[model samples]
Target: MSKSYKKHPYLKESSQHTKYGKKFANRKVRKSEETLQHKDYKKQYCSWEISEYKFYMSEQEVINEFFASRNEEYHWMKKFKTLKEALTWWKKTYLRK
Candidate 1:
């Protein structure tokens, strides 16, 4: 009696000779790593306070509204030494509440 083994025609002896296979594997690994890194970055920066404000207006309109409101609310702050001081005053006066 002789021992017999089944042969698989689709199986390669070694992947070293398969250039296309190696490239495909490399691309798959790079894509998976990039996806994982992106997920981690998103998790680190996730915050509700950083969300967009709920307002329907064009960019110029929004900017105009901001400057108009700031001027009306904190006109005295314009005499401050720096814009930063003016902004701080504005925030404390209007946004803190």
Candidate 2:
């Protein structure tokens, strides 16, 4: 019947897409809120756990911070003798994309 066509055809599919879009937007908002909260909490409380990690302007620390968790990429980091070399490698590997 005409009623069934209007009631069911593409109606469920469109509603599902809308729900998924809303969920994705909500997750993005929650992530941004979490980042803001973390920054605020860090500023309010000087925890030793956060202070334990020292800031260093060295190649090894840069490599560890940026590349070490990326599996195969970090291996190349170990081979680089200087920060310039590492940076050049990073630019070549990442910037082209």
Q: What is the C-alpha RMSD of each candidate to the true structure, in Å?
A: 27.6, 21.3
The 10-residue segment with the lowest total lDDT in model 2 = 3-12
**Which residue ranges in model 2 land beyond 4 Å of their true spot?**
1-76
lDDT of 2 by residue, 1-97 (tens): 2211122111112333245544554455556544555346444334432222222233355567445534564564567666677766644433322
lDDT for 45 in candidate 2 is 33
lDDT, model 1, position 9 = 14
Clashes of each: 0, 0
- lDDT score for residue 75 of model 2: 62
The per-residue C-alpha lDDT of model 2 at residue 93 equals 38
lDDT (Cα, tens digit) per residue for candidate 1, span 12-73: 22335445544554455556544555446444333332322232333344345455656575
